[model samples]
Target chain A: MGISMENGLSTNKSVGKQSVLFQNPPCVLGYSSIAGKKEGEGPLGSCFDIIEEDPLAGGKSWEDAESRLQKKAAELAIQKASLQPKDIRYLIAGDLLGQLIATSFGIVDLEIPMFGVYGACSTMGESISIAAMLIDGGFADKVIALTSSHFAGAEKQFRFPLDYGNQRPLAATWTVTGSGAVILGSPKEVKKLPEDTNPTIHITGITTGKVMDYGIKDSMNMGACMAPAAADVIFHNLSDFDRKPDYYDKIITGDLGYVGADILKDIMKEKGYDISKNHMDCGVEIFSKETQDTHSGGSGCGCSAITLTGYVFKKMIQREWKKVLFVPTGALLSTVSFNEGNSVPGIAHGVVIEIME
Target chain B: MGISMENGLSTNKSVGKQSVLFQNPPCVLGYSSIAGKKEGEGPLGSCFDIIEEDPLAGGKSWEDAESRLQKKAAELAIQKASLQPKDIRYLIAGDLLGQLIATSFGIVDLEIPMFGVYGACSTMGESISIAAMLIDGGFADKVIALTSSHFAGAEKQFRFPLDYGNQRPLAATWTVTGSGAVILGSPKEVKKLPEDTNPTIHITGITTGKVMDYGIKDSMNMGACMAPAAADVIFHNLSDFDRKPDYYDKIITGDLGYVGADILKDIMKEKGYDISKNHMDCGVEIFSKETQDTHSGGSGCGCSAITLTGYVFKKMIQREWKKVLFVPTGALLSTVSFNEGNSVPGIAHGVVIEIME
Candidate 1:
C-alpha cells in the first residue's frame, strides 16, 4: 500500500557506509549537557559519582524549569557544535508537555530556525533521524535534534503519580530525568573525513505504524503498544531490501526493553520473517532492575537517545561494532484512551549506524 | 533573557477578512491521507469546520483523530499542489510527540522518501522553509510539510478543564484544530505556477530562534513568551540584512495575537526598528474568538501553520500582498513547567517569501 521496491521496503542500507564517514560521516560534532540530575555513574562510566547536582526541575517554577532545561541543553549543544546560536540552520526538538513548551521556549534563546516535533518517549530517535537526513539530503548545513521528559512531572500527566501506590506494568518505561542534544553537520571546514566514504548513521528509510489497539491495555506500559510499529519497519527493511537478519551485526530497537523486544520478534516471525540474530534493545539495558527497580525496564525518549549518542555510536567509532540498526519505538496511547478502554498502539523508525570503514 | 518585545499593549480588531476567493496555485502538488480525519476542507470545507468545534485542550487522544486529519490534509495538499504523492521526494513533519507520529503514521500509507522533523510549534514553518530552500537549492524535486492538532485530545494533557474555572492570562492563545500541509517543488514542473512567473515561495533566507526566558512567568500564555523572538528576527532582517519591513507587502508573525503583536512592535522600536505598517499575526486570525470564544487568541504549533497554508500564502499569490515575511511563533512551555510554574518562553523564525520577478 505504500512505497515498495522489490520485496517491499522503502529504505536503502546497502550503500557502503564506510565511505560516508569521510564526506558525510554523520559525526556528532558537538555534545553538551545542562543536566537536571545525573543518576548512573557521574560520567556515565563510574555509575556512582554525581557529576553535577543542579536542580532546575525542583526549585524553578514551571515556566522557569522549561526554560532552564532547554537553555542548558542548548548552551551545551551549541558550544559542542561550535556554531554561533544563530548559525544553526534548524532546531528539531520535542518535550513531554501539552504544547512542547520546553523545547520551543528554550529555542527562543538559541535564535536558530526550528521545527518542533513529537513522538512521545521515542522522540530522541525521531529527532536524530530527521536531523541526520537534513544534513545528508543537503537541506541544512547543521541541525540539532533533542527531546526530554521529567520523571516526577510527566508521571502525573502521562499516567500515574509517583506518589500513587498503583502497581507498575511490565512494559512501563522509566521516564528520563534529564535531556541530551547533539549537533549534526557536514564535514565542513574543521578537519577531514575519508573523502569518498559512504555515510554512517544516515536515515535511509522510514515506516510509521498505525496506532493499533489489541484491547488489552495498560497506561504505564508502552513497549507492547509500540511492538507492531517496530516489526513493520524491521520487516520492511529486510523484505524490501532483500537482506537477511545477519546483514548487519545488530538490529537494535530504541526503548523497547525486554518485553517489547520479544513481542516485536514474535510479531515479525509471525509474518514469516526472523529478526532474532544480533537483535538488541535499549530500554532493557539502561536500568538495573535489581538496583533501579524500573518495573519492566527503563523507558524514555532518552533511553535510546543517550545510549545511541553515548554508548552505541562511541562504541561503533571505537570499532567494537561495525553495523547496527537503531529503531526508536513509541507508544501512541494517551491517558484519555487508557481511561476510555482503548489499548495502546505502537510505531517505530529504524536507522543504520556503522563505523567509518 | 527570553524574547523581550512585550510592551503589554493590546491591539484587538474585529475586522473580517476581505471577501476573497480561495484558490490553489499550481506551483504546488501532491496529496496523501492519514487515519482519515484529513486536512483542509477536503474538497468540501466540512472537515476543518468540524475540528473547529469543541476543540481539544489537552490530555485527549490523537491516535484516532490525527489519523483522519493528517491523511486528508496530505491528500488535499498534494492535490491542491497538483502533484501526486508518489512523486514527492520527501515528507517532513513532527509535533509534540516522540515518534513525530502524525506525519509518520499518517505518511506510512503514502509512498515517498520521508524524513520526520520536530521543532515544537515552529514545526510547520521550519518544515516549509526547509522545503522551499531544498527546492531552490535543487536537492529535492518536491517536499511536503504536514502538521495537525486535536483540541479534546490536547486539552486533556496540557491544562485543567476548560470548565475548570481557571483564568487565562492576557497573553494566552488557543491552538488551531486543523492540520496544514504544503507541497513544494520546482515551478517548472507541471507548469503548476503561472507560466510567466516563478513561484512566489522561493525561500531566500531563514533565521532560527533560541531558548530564552528573561524570567517569563506564565507557561499558559505563549505569545508573551515568544514575541521577543519574532522581534529579534524582524529587527535582524532590518538591521542585519539592511532590509525594511516594507520590502514585503505584509509581514506575518505565525500566531502572536493582540498581546504578542503589540510586544513585537515595541521590541522593534526599542531596537530602532518598526514593522507596524503591515504586521499581522496568524494566531489571532486563524480562529475567531468572537465565534470560538477563545479568550486571548489562537496559539499552538499549528496555529501559524494553517494560517500560512490557508491564509497568508493565498493572499500573496492573489497580489493582495507580496513579498511576505513568515515568522511562525512558538511558545516553549510544556505541561511539566506549567506544573513547575515556569513562565512560557517563545521563539519565532523568519522566512522571506517572494516570487521571482
Candidate 2:
C-alpha cells in the first residue's frame, strides 16, 4: 500500500500527457534495410543493404516475397550488431498485412520473444518507441524493431489487383517494397560494441501518437489523411520539450508524400510553428518525381523504415545530423472499412534520436 | 557518453530473460466487459456489464457490431473509473479483422492516443502487458487495454460466410461475441478510487512470449497449435520466478480449449512442472459443453478479455483468488498463409497479477 514498490521501477520519466523521456537512452547498435527492385531504382537505392531484383525472390506469392524481405533485413541487422538472434531478447515487428503475415512468416525462424504491433505506416516509429522503452526500463538487453511492405502485396490487399490495372489518382503514393530492422541495445550492450565503429546513436525520448481522424475518406490520398496526425505529434513534441523547430537538425515525417507534406506545413503554421524550412518527408525523399513516375511519392510501412535505416541512420553515424525527430504517420483504415464508407484515421509516433558525443 | 542521463529514468527491473519484475506495480483501477446474447447464456454471462440480444446491435454489418462492442466496453470502463474519455491518455486495443478495423472504427470517437496491437486471441494479454509497462515506466498515468471479437465477424473473415452454413469441425472453437477493457493506473491515480471500493489489483510481473512453431498446420485445432508456445511461457515464468504451479491460486490460459488444455498440461509435465491440478482455461470455463453447442469452447481476443474483466477480476476483488498467472496464447497464422500450405506459429504472453493486503 505504501507506493506498491513490489515490482515497479523507480523512475519518473513521463514528461507530459503522452510522452516519455528515457533516463538511460537505448543506443541504436546497428540497422539493416532491404529494398525491392523498384525501391532499388529509387534515389536511396545505394543506401539499402540488399536489393532483390525478383520481387518473388523464388517464393510462390507476393506475401512470401515480403516475408523474405523481412527475414533478410532482420538477419542483416543482427549480423551488423555482431550478435546472434538469440542474443536479442525481443523482436518488435509488424507489416502492412492482415494479421501481420509478413512479420510472422518472415521472422519466425529467429524465435525471439515478439510483440506484434500495428500502427500502419507508423509501425517503424511505434516499434522503436516501444523497444526503447523496454530497453530503458530494463525489460530487455537488446531488441530488434522491424517492419516491411511490398507494392503488389499491399495493392492487392488495400486497393486494386494487378490484373485490373486500374489507373491510380495523382494523390496516390506507391507502396515501397522493402523492410528495415534496427537493433536497440542497452548502455551495457553498447559498451561491448566494436571500438572501430563511430559512436552509437541513442534514442533519447519518444512521444506516442493518438488516432486523429480528419474525416478524410479517400484511401488513395493517405498523405492528406495522415498530415493532421503528423502535425499533432510534431506540435506535442515541440511543446512537451519546450523546443523550437530548429531544436533538431530536421523534423521528419514518415510517408506524407508531396501532398501530405504541404498539408503538414500548413497545419504546423496554424499552430504557430513553421517547420517548412527544415522539414523532410521520408516518402518524398525516397523517390524522384521526374524519373520514378510515382504520382505522389512512396508510402508504406517500409517507406519510413528503410529511409531511416538507410539514409537517416547513416547520416547520424557520420555526424551530419546531431539530433532529429523521426515521426512516422499511419493511415488506419482497411478495404472493408473503406467499402463501408468509413473515413481514414491517422496516427503518428515520434522518436528523438541523437548522437552521444 | 556516460549513460546519457539526459531525460532518462533510473531503475533496473528486468530479471533473467523474457520477463520483467515490476518494482512498483501498476494497479488495475477499473474494468468493464460486454458480451453478446449467446455469451450471456454461458456460465459467466451474469458477470458482464451489458448483454445485447442482437448480434447486429442495430448496426448495418457484423464488423459494425464488433465496433459497437469495443466502444461500449471502453466507455463503460472509463465510466467505472469515474473518468471521461479525455482523461485516459492512451487506448491500446486490437481485434482479428484486417488492419484492426473493429478497434479503429470503434474507438475513433474516443480520440485517445492508441497503439493498435494484434496477437490473434492473445491480444488481451498483449494489451495488458503493454499497458502495464507504460504505466510502470511512467509513460502514462492512465491507459486502457482493450480487445474484442464477434463470432459472426470472425467466421466471415477467417472461414466461410454465415450464409454458406458450412459445418465446422469439432476442434474449432466458437469466437466469443464480446469486448473487455481494463484501465491501468499509476499509484497516485489508484489512491483517488472510490472509498467504498475494494483494494486495487496490481500487475506484478510479465513474461513476453516468443513465436514457437511446433509444425502445426491445422488452424481449426488452434489449441493444439498454441499449446507449445503456452507451455514455453508458462515454463519460463515458473523458472524465472523460481515458483511452482501452486504459487498462484489459478494458472489461467486464455483460450486453449479442451484439446489445447491437455496439450499444455502435457507439455508442462515434460518440463518437470505439473499444472494439472490448478489449471483453468477461460475457453473451457465460459461455456457448459452440453448446453452451449460450442465445439471445443469459446475463443478469440474477447474470450480471455471478457473472462478476465468479468469473472476473474470479480473473484480477485472478493479475495477468492489471491494471485493469478494469466497466459493468453495465440496461433499466428493467416488465411493467406494457410492456403499457401504454411504452418501456423503460436505465441503466448504471461502476466502475473496479485492483490496486496
C-alpha RMSD for every candidate: 8.5, 4.5
Question: Across residues B1-357, which tens digit of lDDT does each residue of candidate 1 receive?
Answer: 111121111111100110000112124443222211222322323323233332221224454455456667777776655556666665776554433444545565675545455555677766775565445433445678777765544454566665676776666666556677877665555454432222554555555455456677765666677788778767655543456668878888877777888888998878876788889887667555565556667666566666666666556657787677788776655565655555666666667666544
Q: Candidate 2's error at B161, in angstroms?
A: 0.8
Q: Model 1 residue B87 lDDT?
A: 61
| Chain A vs. native, model 2, TM-score | 0.95
Among all candidates shown, the one with the greatest DockQ: 2
**Tens digits of lDDT, candidate 1, A210-328:** 33444447666577778877777777666645567787787888777778888988998898877787887877766666767676675666566666655666556556777777777
lDDT for each residue of candidate 2 in B103-167, tens digit (9 for 90 to 100): 98899888787888989999988999988888777777788999999999999888889999988
User: CAPRI verdict on model 1?
Assistant: incorrect
Which lDDT value does model 2 have at B129?
92
The fnat score for candidate 1 comes to 0.27
True contacts kept of each: 0.27, 0.60
lDDT of 2 at B316: 89
